[model samples]
Target: MRPNARFTDVQPIGLDAVAAAAGTDPDVLRLENLDTDVPPPPAAVAATTQALASGEGNSWLPLTGLPVLCEAVAGELRSRTGLDYDPSRQVVITSGGTSAVMPVLLATTEPGETVALTDPTYAGLLQRVRLSGARPHFLPLRVEGGHWRLDRDALTQVTTAAALLLMSPSMPSGVLLDRDDWAAVAETCARTGAYLIYDAAMERLVYDGHPRINPCQVEGLAERTITIGSVSKEYRMIGWRIGWIAGPVDLMDRIRMAVIYNTTVSSGFAQLGAAAALTDPSGSGVDEAAAEYQRRHDTVIDQLAGLPVVRAAGGWSCLVNATALGLTAPELSSRLLRYGRVAATPMTAWGGTIAPDYVRLVYSREPVERLSDLRYRFDTALTSG
Candidate 1:
């Protein structure tokens, strides 16, 4: 947000800047994107192939979603939360998870309403809040005991929100909300009549045997919970760009209309592919992907052991405290790119709570072998004088 309403300038996202600077350099260790090199599930690929040949998902009639795909998402949620959502009236498809978020924001909040979100959240999500004309109230995450935690004090502020837009394994910081944290949020929402809008794109990408509890599982939260998920992060189907929004049937009507108005509908074949991935009893390969990502995460943290890197319990990236290292985030990022050939993003405008010296290093895109030399690169970069 601007310092004042009179100030209309908006901050540029750090990811795009790093991406443009990194370019197509084969030698530059590309740690600037949330992308994963892991391929999509075999079942999804096969289904997309079949859809292309037979044209099953080629229609524009059902803008909400394909009946099969909606059921698949409903079943997926049911398995995770043990709460049932009617596929027919509770799910709507979108061009992508990013696309789905805007409509959800639109549905849950109004112009000038407060939307509670974590500090250091996804830049895209923060931007969408501004686009939807809602004011953002950030609940800061603290790095305590070398791991990220939702500052228990921030939970009190949820009462002032029209909705709480959050993600477990939150991007950039990799802060995962545990059972107690979620219980507090659920209780607050129930007490204050605030909506719980969950961004579940990377819900399955946990590390080190951590337990992930859905907000729906927290007593009385199911009816107030709105989940937005996609195949992008967990399913490795970024190109497919398929996502869904599910919630109470009455709220779902407004959400469906918002999505329909905003994106018209998601791609037909991609929806079929996502359906196939979600329904495959064999699974969607998320566990294998998370394992690979954990290895990469470990290597980077290990290499930067003496540095100011915070451990990411889950998700694809972690933060480095540039201020503690005696440098601003952009300056550190520039040094890494120039001297170390490493592309890392500065967390400048992601949220108000991110300090001026925070830089994000993405581990999902690169292999562990390539990341083994992280220390050498960092030492070379930081000690360059």
Candidate 2:
């Protein structure tokens, strides 16, 4: 191991293991990953197909990304944040949202520097911070009033951080950050001089009339924020592997260098599809998909109503309190997979104190029809195992 490496505390999220164990068992519901059965925009698919057939943009050139895709990303950011981004100067396409994250961390922080992240945040992100040689400082998300919330007191803790990774409709917990949360975030960042790396993978994937304040919308955060977005969630284009980073021109050069060196750009052909997905309003299907995901989220809550599952205000997964069952999350995960036919992932080192006490049930992957049997499965898993 390299002396500078910092991934010793990082544990696998258990999705791959659970998924591999699930194998060809069609009966096993695949809730272990962030996926959707919903199709991508037809225009995106068509564009990708055309790009592949034409063999256009098959070179290692254009290290940033396709012009159209970058412009589309800038436009999207502008519409949501009301902050204009110069496509050429302030944007760089990435392999995916996850890929974009590490580069931002690398660009913004030095080894042993602190990077604030939410406890119960994506394990991938926590591990990425570790991989980049940064200390992961978690802002605990307290379960309050049937929803997940960041601890206001904990926001003051991150004032020493070099970067703060934030996501609305935060993964696993599905907690949408409100106005107060954004305000607290602004205060923390302003005090710390930390870069706000906002993950927009599921920005628009909110539900039940909850509002998400774009980080850039917070006073002083527009220039302080670096937004990372991808087609994986909102546009339902996971396979395309295209993501973008948008920030101020001053900080963007280092981020762009990190982007180029990190993954050397997303697939050239896939960029065309992502551009199509971003530009084609009618076919993006974001709002419609959010509605369906909300239905699925509600269904999961209903199915596991009596269980200690936390309500997901928005996003893909629901956190089931494994501690209530007198078992660790990994133990519950195994039993659920074996007996319940559910492939929920155990929150091992995902982050925070409550992490290991819970397992995640990703609602986006399965349809409501398949999830109707969730209660029975949980019953069997709980009783038998």
Candidate 3:
């Protein structure tokens, strides 16, 4: 039997193709990216090595998760979010954050139901919602005071009997939802009985001295809001593919069932490594990476400020309005690779009705020293064109 082909319509990530076309080498800086340059913490490394040596991690963990890791995650949540979450009940460790969401969508929405998101949001969620046989409803975010804000009333009007998936410190723009915004969204979800799927993927990479807030902390939202996150960003363990879904036990039970077919279980040794990151995250690799990202963010911002075409905020990416150079985002992106030798992702692929003129330049992957090269080449391209 042929598998569903809905995925074919979903384009592969532009960054990978762009990087390939740009011909990345050790000497060239790669800024169009996510994840970190640093490795996972030593504790995780040591524990994984120990687990492998003892042959302890060879067995598959339970569908729900390894009990110890689940408990550790629970403790981490209480410490970080100040919300008392029962690990044994509320946590289901999936392969990663992406795995966590699929089951949540299946459990919460029926075919043809809507999954709403802010405009120009994360691309992955858009593809996931479509894959689940749901329509995507977009609420275009208006920029005010150099930050993106949701129109609550507009969102309520467009979406009913749907699930809203949102990322805090959102991708591309990196706008962290304020307390008031969170309250408004929570209230909307409650009134409408819409399941809230909070993707805390980019929340930890926050800048401008903002505190991270989980949507589950909203009053009466613990039962309704499902949070999907990973050890990728903060733990710098993107390769480990460890992530989770935390919410109501009953809801998580359904997610656990859907997880049975998708790789069945994550790597046992990797889970051990992930547990160490969760339990002893402070001295872990996150601090150094966070500092490096902060510096890179600053460097990218400074470099883009010199460019007539690029503007950015929050995350380690700059969205350049490239239409003035007489090219669509993809065309400009192609040109930047062939001519300027800079790789960037066009914003059009991210879904919604974002301007086709804009391209997202990921600054995180490039080292601080190499940033000047990308800037010089990129700016010169704009000038010469």
Candidate 4:
């Protein structure tokens, strides 16, 4: 049976794939979305509701995006990142962070041009890069005490003439890139003339009292940097299908072309909701959610950190080295699902070099009180096997 080439080699994402490989309970307790357990701001919801009630919610938006949302986005960027982005010229609202990546790829790279991404990165990023028909050069991240390290030499070598896709407070590992790492990456990209694509999806999810460092904040990199951000993680609006991109004007124009040609327009009313989110994030319904996630981070990391089997990394999750217990991550994940009623992602999904032996446990969506039970389950699964 020949599978369609487009998806032949891609790993299946269904539940059956979990059962077939792990021989554990197929039903997974999903906590991977990192979605806020809170609702959107009343102002945003009310605005959207009003738009819906008015019966004008069904309309195509502009290719360059809604002017109101774009201006709001510019204001937010100026406030948050201190970058003066012309919303009209530099911002394009898309379906989500997922949609934002493709257009950037379309705008920047020619076919066969390489994309350099960090290893143990966000899994979906690899798929997007591949979908764009570009080669992904994975730069392996060195895990130090509670953080992930970038190999500057490896980064420089791979980044020569390659587009760089970097995620801050990266997925799974949750290791936030510090100032020095950002500097090296910026310098490397500048030297190589590569486009720096910063995925700040989980930028706001940084824990342990770490300050948020926008990679675009680095000097001289803003002109060449393409920033993709989402309201999903920060504003509790994943269902809104509203995300945005900010970059150099010329590149942004090209991305708008790609967006218009493909999806045409995202929901007009949803853009309004997202605009509201951008304008008043602290006042948005996410402050409580961020507080909750912060609590979960503290609870999970403190519990898992003392365990010899796991090392706590900053972000929304903890990365456990499963090989230390003589079992692969998939095997342990399967067993945990069945016996412990838990589920975790195998790190290989993110191109981690030692993925088979490591699992990423997302803590954000889980209730803080249940973290104790999760820790116990993990202990049983890892030690028993």
TM-scores for all predictions: 0.96, 0.97, 0.91, 0.90
Give the 10-residue window scoring lowest on summed lDDT in candidate 2. Answer: 1-10
Best by TM-score: 2
Let me know the TM-score candidate 3 reaches against the reference structure. Answer: 0.91
CA error at residue 376 for candidate 4, angstroms: 1.9
Candidate 2 lDDT, tens digit per residue, 207-245? 888785687888878878999899999899999998898
Pairwise lDDT winner, candidates 2 and 4:
2
Which regions in candidate 3 have their CA more than 4 angstroms from the true location?
A: 1-9, 281-283, 306-315, 324-326
Predicted candidate 4, C-alpha RMSD = 3.1
**Residue 132 displacement (Å), model 4:** 1.1
lDDT tens readout by residue for model 1, 276-331: 99999888898998898899999989999989999998889999998898888899
TM-score of 4: 0.90
Each prediction's Cα lDDT score? Answer: 0.87, 0.88, 0.73, 0.72
Looking at candidate 3, the ten consecutive residues that score lowest on lDDT are 306-315
lDDT tens digits, residue span 216-241, model 3: 77786667888887887777788888
Cα-lDDT of candidate 3: 0.73
